[model samples]
Every structure is written in C-alpha cells, then in structure tokens.
Target: MANPNVKIWFFGGVNEIGGTKILIEDLGYDVCVFLDFGKSFSVEKQYYSYPNIPRSLDELIRINATPDASKMPVLQGLYTQSEITKLSQQKLLELEKSNQFKEEQESNIDAIVISHAHSDHYQYISLINRNIPIHISECGYNILKIRKWIERPSLTNNLFLLNVHTFKTGQSIHVGSLKIEPVHVDHSIPASYGFIIHTSGGTVVYTGDFRFHGHNPFLTYQFHDKILENEPIDVLLTEATHVTKSILSNEDEIGRKLQQAISATERLVIADFSDTDFDRFRSYYNTAKELGRSLVVTLRQSLILGALNICEGLATPNILKDETIKILIPKREDPTKPVTGERLSSWQKIYYQHLGAEVKGSVQSEDLWMPFKEMLAKMGTPPEEKLISHAQMLNKSREYVLCPSFNTIGDLQQVKPAAGSVYILSTSEPFDEEREIQFEKLLNWLELYGIPMLHVHVSGHVHP
Candidate 1:
C-alpha cells in the first residue's frame, strides 16, 4: 500500500464540467494540498429568477450545495471530491453564522492555485474563506474582481480574502515544497493557464481545461521545451475535452464555416451564447455585421463591451455602439411578476442605455426590475400579441444572442421554442468528452423542437 500522504487524487472535473477537486499529499512533510474545489451542475440544480426565465447550459449541473453521499456518474470513484463539494455547500448555507470556514481550511490544504475564471474553475474557490491565500494569474484576478461585483457582495464578504497573486505567463512561484510554474496558453478565454507542479518526487503538468484548435502546436512546443528545461515529468494531467479525432477544425476554419452557415440563413440570426465567451460571441456579432445585417444582442452580453476595461475582452467600440444592435432588458413594466435585484453599472449601464435596450432582468438593474413588475408587470395572462410586439422581438430572425443549449426539462417559459430553432450552436468541437455526450443530450432536445442545424457554430479556442 502506498503512503496516504504521497497520493494525488483528482476528486472532481476529471472528465466532467464541475466538481474539480485535486488533492496532493506528501506524507514525508505531513502535508496535503487541494488543487481546485469546483462543483458540477445538473438540470435539476438550476436557479431561476422566475420560472419564465430561459434556462442556460450552465444550469444543467447539479449545483453542489452540500457535501453528500450522492455520486456523479462521471465522478463516481472520486469520493473525496463528492464529500468536499457537499461539505462546501453546507458551509455556504451556514456561512451566515460564523467565520470558521477560514480557520477550517488549514486542515489539509497548503495553497490553491487557480488556472482561470470559468465558472467551473473559480466559483468553488469563491466558497473558500479569507485566510487561505490563492495564487492565480493577473487575468484570473481581474475576472474574480468582476465576478464579485457581479455576484452578491454581502454573501461573499470575506471574498476580499481572495488574496489573488498574479503570476506572469511563464513565471514560477514557490509555496513550501510545491513549486508551480504558470504558462500562458490559449483556451476559449485568454489568460487561461496550464500549470507544471514540481515536488520532491517528480513533476506533473496539469492542463486545467484547455482547447488546442489553431494555436495548439504552440502548446506542444511549450510542452517539449518545458520537458527539456526541467527534469522529466511523471504525469501529464491533460484535459481530454476533444481527445477524439473529431476536434479537427481550428478556430479560424470553424469561424469561416459558421460564417458560411450564417450566410445561408436569411432572417436575422439570433444566437444564445455565454456572454463571458466574448470571442465566439463577438465572432457571431462580427459575422452579423459583415453580412450587412444588424446583429442584435441582449443587455447581458452587451455588458461585456464596457468590461474590456477589466481585461482583454472582445467588445469593440464600433461593434459596441452599432445602431442596428438592439439589447434586451426586462420589460420596463412588470411584463410578468415583480423582480428584485441590484443594478450593476459604472459604464455598462450608460453604454446599454445609449444603445437603447435596458428594460430590466440582468445582472445589473435586477433591483430596478422590481419596479418593472408594477410598471410593466403583466396583471393576468400576457397581453395580446400586439402588446407583446411592443417589446421589440426579432423581426424575421436577423437578431441573435447565443443562449443556453438545452431545454428546461420541465421548468418555466412554456414556449420552449421546440428546442432547435431558438438556440444557435457553434461549429466548434464539443468542450470536452463529457460535453460531447452532453451536447448529444441537447441535440436530442433540438430533435424534439426540430431545431435544424444543431451543430452550426465555431470554436473560439485556438489550435496549432
């Protein structure tokens, strides 16, 4: 039997989207360091502002609210990950009672080095307390700061303890016995990192969720260079997101293909995508403009435009200020029930307001949305089509905002759009193997709605 402290276990996010927990133990030093603590999602775990709000792909996971015995099918063997997520969830609920979470972290962990700011990567880290300092990239730190601004400020008070240490792309930082080197690599998002961990025994290069589409060869070269520069690495913890031969198209090629596909469509193309994924999202926006049609986006996505100040996001001034561009906000009046949430603004509010579409129902203006309830709130059944028409929906389909890829299963917004027609998927390869399978699930849904062209998209991540 190997020593307990010498083992390295990937508790979550091995092949799935969430519950990414990795533990490294060194019995010789009586130490164990937790790599990442992220939770996965299930359609059942989705949160809704109102039942009517459309569902998103992120909503598909069973949010780990508590550490429990239940196991994720993909992550069944990783018992340690499951327990941690469950416990983390429980602690979050009781977080109101005490500041003990900070003190409890030292139980086994020496440090946490975050790779990026994707929900699966850093949301769980946000769950950790003030005392534990986290090592991260500069971009990751900016993203976390923005995330705090986006999520509730009160619930995550100690989040300021999110001591984010920004390391350069090639810089290496040492923590006790663990020496970690951060390498800048291309993922769908910029500043995403793949780390090389050096320990007494050997080294391991963990690819924290990456895609090598067009500039991928750069990673291969870097990999070989690192091997030559350092001693031999014992393990290469890589993400098999597109391990299959299917991930062949590079970002440019996929973008071109998506362009061709969009060209084939007549009406304004409305796509539902993660606003955070500015590259692909902006690509679509650019494509729409290139075709001489106005590409309409929602306030949520357009919000990304001003955030360029945060870092290297994809929103451009011309594109951000486009006239044909329309932004969606909650109806000024309670088009439905009342709403409640604070508004986020510094420049985006003015930016969106200038573009002419800031009704309500967004990360910002959520609180103002409450007045919309009384102002534009639908008292009984929705108003006649004429009244709804006043809301400025798509005119024959040219406008597009990339949205969730799946159906509500049984949630709100009864229109459902049958599945396929409403959501515009990119031609990019599936995010990971599990994502490939999950994409199949969404495809099945599109089959229900008979939404044509399910795989009509491109990848923002690069490859060599």
Candidate 2:
C-alpha cells in the first residue's frame, strides 16, 4: 500500500532537459532529502549570457535558476553562511513583505544525493549549505574535485568546500529514516548512478540520467534487473531524454566509424567531443593508436584523464606513461617564452611542475586553496615529461589527432590545418539558440581553414 505521508516535489527537470532538483519529503519521519540538485542550462540561458551570470544566490533564486528558498521556508537554512550573507537586504525585505521569511537555522534537509558529475545535474551544489552532507559515488566525487582545481574560481563554483561523503555501488546510505542505495548505471561520464530509496512511506526509484547503448550496456541491464527486484515501487522517477528520437548507435560502432574516418584523412584530424566523455576519449585514443597517430588532448582534458586514472577500477590511461598520448599546452601570453608556472593558473602550475618543467612563479597559498593542494598531494608524483607546445603541434599536424573543444577551437588558426585535414563533430547537435550560435561559429572556423567536417556521434541516451 502507498504511504500517504510521503510527498514529492519537482522543483526543476520538468518539460526541459537537465537542471534536476527533486525533493523527497518523508512526513512520517519529519525529514527531507533532495535528489540531484543540478543546474538547468535552459533556465540559466533564459536570463544570463556568457560573462554575465547571477551575482548572488538571491539573484539565482529570484530568476528561478535554482529552487526558490524565499518561497519555501523549508529551504531557508539550506545555503552556506558565506552565500546567505551575500543576499541583498532588499531581497530580505521582499521575503519579509511576502510573509515568506524564516529565521535561518541549521539545515533541515538530511542530505543531497548526487547521481553524477554532469554540470546540469550537480552545478548548483556549490550554493548548498555545507552542513547538509552530500552523498555521491566515489568516481563522481573525484571528477568534481578535479573540475574544481581546473575551473577558474567564482561565486557559483565553490565545490571545493562541499561536505561530501563518497559511496560505491550497492552501498546503502542512511539519512534519518530513509535508506538510499546507489546503483551504477551506464552514461557518457563514468560513475553515474540511479537510486532506490526506502523511505518511511514506500520504496521510490529515481533514475538519474542513464543510457544502455554505450560500452557497458550490461550495467543498465543490471539496473533494470535491480529495479524489478524492488517491484511494487510506490513511485518511479525516470529520465525520458530520447523518448521521441529514433537514431541509435553504440560505442563499438562509433569506434569503427571513427577509425574509418581517420584512416581516410592523410593530414590533420580534429575531433570535438565533451571533455569528460571518457568513452569517446577512448574511441579517439584507440583510433589514433591504430592509425599510428598520437592522440593530442588539451591541458584540461589531460588533467581530467589524470584524475580518472587515479581512481580505482577505472582503467584510464596514464598520460605521462602513454607514449601515443600528448598534452597540447595552450599558448601563454608571452609567445616567445617556454610554458612556465608564472604564466599559468594555480592548478596549471602544479600540473607543469609534475611534468618536470621549470616553474618560475610561486604557487598560491594552501590556506585559500586547500582542496587543490590536497588533491594534488593525493595524486603523488607522476613520471616527469615535456608537454607538446602549440608550435610543435602545428609543425607535426599530420602526426597527431587533435581533440579540441569549442573554447579551444581557435587553436586551428595557428595550426592552419593543411589540405586534406578533416574535422569530426563527435557530439550532439545544438539543442538551443545559444548552442546554435556556437555551432555556426565552429563551422566558420573550419571553413576558414578549408577543412572538411564530419559528424560521427552516438548519444549518451538510449533511443525510444
């Protein structure tokens, strides 16, 4: 029988893709737990553009970029002290005028369970109160930690300070009277999971973004079998991302397609895909190896790979040890000088130092950046090696398969891809006006170099 005491609220992830925030309240136990407090790209784009973002937590809530704490007193104390202090006095007055103001107490929420590390699913976590423990998979936690180090510091990206608790698949987490069991599911990014919550009311299943058409379809199959074992579920929250789409492909097919495309090109081969999509990264890496071409990745991608390599059971290639893999360091302000710590960010300085390169500048104090310091310390000393410079990549264009994102596509101007060079768009097509504009810009860059572009992509979601 269904327990009437259990209630669910959909604060986001409805009628739009991403930005998933589901609140599961157990009235019988007098406790609440949130599932996946992620940002919605659609909602964010509605109000802000690049370089112009919400200045404070109050602004994010007011614009509906995140859940509105002012309207729901239950959410009143669920933000970090530093962030709440930044709320404008006018916003507080507005809350009081609407009879929605509540005294900020310790967080009432039991915990926030993250299903994955995708920005759409976990970006807003920085604004969450540190008192509220965040439960995530071990792989997801490591990915977020690395992202914090590489990304530029900002008000909305304080992920380093999160009070996190890591769990493995099948591990059960108890928050008040609720028991959450995270089960691994296949997705574009590693360490993705779905949750089966045993609440005071009933058993509810929430499927965070998942797909069965990737390298490990069996993982999603296992999740399905697990769901059947918990039959008579009172509620089921599942993703319907590709319900209307029919096109489908798998990792093996994509690998073969990539190899064929790379073999046909005699000159430079440029591949564009998500930085965190390790499955696609493997595909490109394997193709490069088979074709006797080095797989060149951006500094950010190299750092992500290095992070993944440290996590147990991921089997990621070590960039420092892999002879066929090369790190493409971006050009510094002084084009004449060799890459050094003085020209890099705090995290980049550490990475370059690890590569045995001469670092001239002082690193940032650990007092302000403990997480980056601690994470690097955990990684230990890697094999010292030299990074490939932009000039080196340009001269040896035919010897490498360059993987650059839209942000780094400008590098093509320096490489000036020789004739017969090809660009592969191994990612999804634009889903919105902003992305459409970016897509056009990418096309312009390829056209400028007279490089032929090919689309070879398999989605991270299953087809209907």
Which candidate leads in TM-score? Answer: 2
Residue ranges of candidate 2 with Cα displaced over 4 Å:
83-104, 332-338, 366-385
Sequence-dependent TM-score of model 2: 0.91
Candidate 2 CA-lDDT value:
0.78
- lDDT by residue (1-464, candidate 2, tens digit) is 26778889888899889899999889888879999988878888999897897788778888787877767867767777654344432332243335543434587788999999998889888788767889998878888878766765455665744678999886899997789989988999888899998888789999898888898888888888998998878899999888899776788999999989999977889998888888888889888888889988877877676677667666556655676787776665233354555566766776766665666787655344455556655555545343777667767777889988547467676556777899998889999999899888878988877888899998987678
What are the lDDT scores of the predictions, listed in order?
0.49, 0.78
Q: In the order shown, what is each candidate's alpha-carbon RMSD?
A: 9.8, 5.7
Error of 1 at 46 (Å): 13
TM-score of each: 0.63, 0.91
